[model samples]
Target chain A: MNNNTSIIVTSEKLNLQTCYDFVKDPSCGGIALFVGTVRNHSYQKEVTLLNFSSYSSMAVKEMTKIAEQAIASFDIYKIAIHHATGDLQIGDIPVIIAVSSAHRGAAFKACEYAIDTLKETVPIWKKEHFIDGQVWVNTHP
Target chain B: MKIKVLFFGIFTDIFGKTTIELEVPSPINVVELKAFIIKNNPKSTALHFAVALGETYADDNARIHEQQVVALIPPVSGG
Candidate 1:
């Protein structure tokens, strides 16, 4: 684990300011952050809420791996990743990725890679509760 | 050998419980363990799933040992 990397999976609401604080470094010249929020609709359905579940142990492990990869792949000073579980309403933040680097290019690229890789590998699932019914998103074909 | 199986995401919905303990023969691989799970809980076969041994993702040929933490992982949708 990198000393500057922070990996968190929780049920509480995410705080963006904390993420910014975590990645703040005097030596870094630029910071990039990505915030993923619950959307109002999915597949043309009116989504009312989302309930998230995760294999906590593996989720953290995979998240750490992504952070480590980002640290090694990019010229970044620090990285922080936080994800939320349980029920969340539309417009609520579910995930946040922060990266700090000596240049804007590295910060931006590393931030994008972190979020993209996290979506593909992390063991977290979201079930959208529509007005009429609810279904786990992306579970089946 | 007794193995502990943990369910997550849609798998928990299919299994109707979070954790299950099963007794299988010794030296079982991940493929065989998945087969045993599907045989006992047929609904689990409906979704494409992967297995994780401890903190790492396990391939189908990976061997399962006694008291290892095993988890069923469905397709991920996190952002």
Candidate 2:
């Protein structure tokens, strides 16, 4: 991917503005953003918090690969994918994807593809904490 | 041959450590390495995982070598 792709995997909070600024281009007409946040409930149970961990180096490479694929398949100008690590309370942002394109359709589609592929391929894991106990979701098997 | 293996998330809890160095036969492929891991760490025998070499996922046929970083990755949920 080109330098326009901003891929970040951090324990710090994810900023929508930083991602937006990176993808914003005067040449592009539309910018699409996807923000993933922690929810209070899941599978009919209450979720108190979430813990995210990853193979950091591999996660960045996978995110870059997704961005490259988005650029290759879509008419997008730039893309930014950022994910959070460590403990996150309910409503905390876990991920943000920003895509800019000359048209709205490509931007929207690329943003979706970026996030969808990330969930499947990235080397990050999420543990949902409940008052009773906790379990890992989206087990590979 | 000594290979460095990395554990994350649940694997860390199961292994009780972040990384470990293992000695194995020289010509062991990814498949054999996985079998060795499960046999040694019986708790992981039932869980499915992907073997990663460096920044990419290594297929079963991929040859593993000494001093290489290998990660045992469970299913991902990054969003």
Candidate 3:
């Protein structure tokens, strides 16, 4: 449950196993993970693909801040956050967040909070491609 | 000097590029660059955005580095 237990990656090539293992330690007990994949539909429209772009540095910083805040607020043992940038097809793992804590309650809370904070604060934007057309939503983050 | 300015989401369509460059004097900060951009493109004033500097979120107090990659991020709808 030290500094090495956390990672923040924004790469085209993602190593899910590596990220999972990074926070997988024989600590207290529970290890909760959240893998956000691109869904095939959004609001009933068929989604073809998703293009995720991030202000890499800022996104990383914001993610780190979330991790730090979670660690401080919750009893989490370790944390890992990895997000993919570039073109992503349906079912692609766009974001992965793992949290380890002594108990399941803290793990679940921290994991959910981490992803929610990332969406709210991280400097990353995604474009949705539908069958009819594509639209860029939200330009005020 | 010149720097790379990236726009995400709807801003891309408005600016027509994932990235652009702002011509400005040396040693400009985030606020100054935003002001410069607004002055050049008054239409952009209607939009609210956030600036990201090399792995860190930038605000009005953030400093601009020479040749640094800056991204203008708009609100996102993805869950």
Q: Who is ahead in TM-score, 1 or 3? A: 1
For model 2, how does the per-residue alpha-carbon lDDT over B1-79 read when each residue is reduced to its tens digit?
A: 9999998878887788999998988889999998888888746347578899977999999999888888999778877
Tens-place lDDT per residue, model 1, A52-119, is: 88888789999999999999999999999999999999999999999999999999999999998898
Listed in order, each prediction's TM-score against the native is 0.94, 0.95, 0.79
Q: By the TM-score metric, which is better: model 1 or model 2?
A: 2
Instruction: Name every residue pair that clashes in candidate 1.
Output: none
Q: Indicate the DockQ of the complex predicted as candidate 1.
A: 0.67
Please give, for residues B1-79, the per-residue lDDT of candidate 1 as tens digits: 9988888887777888899887988889999988777777756356577889977889999999998778888889887
Specify the CAPRI tier of model 2: medium
Model 3, residue A111: distance off in Å is 0.6
What tens digits encode model 3's per-residue C-alpha lDDT throughout B1-79? 8888887777777777777776777789988887777677635446666677765567798878878887766785433
Two-way TM-score contest, 2 vs 3, winner: 2
Residues A15-51, candidate 2, lDDT per residue (tens digit)? 9999999999899999999999999999999999999
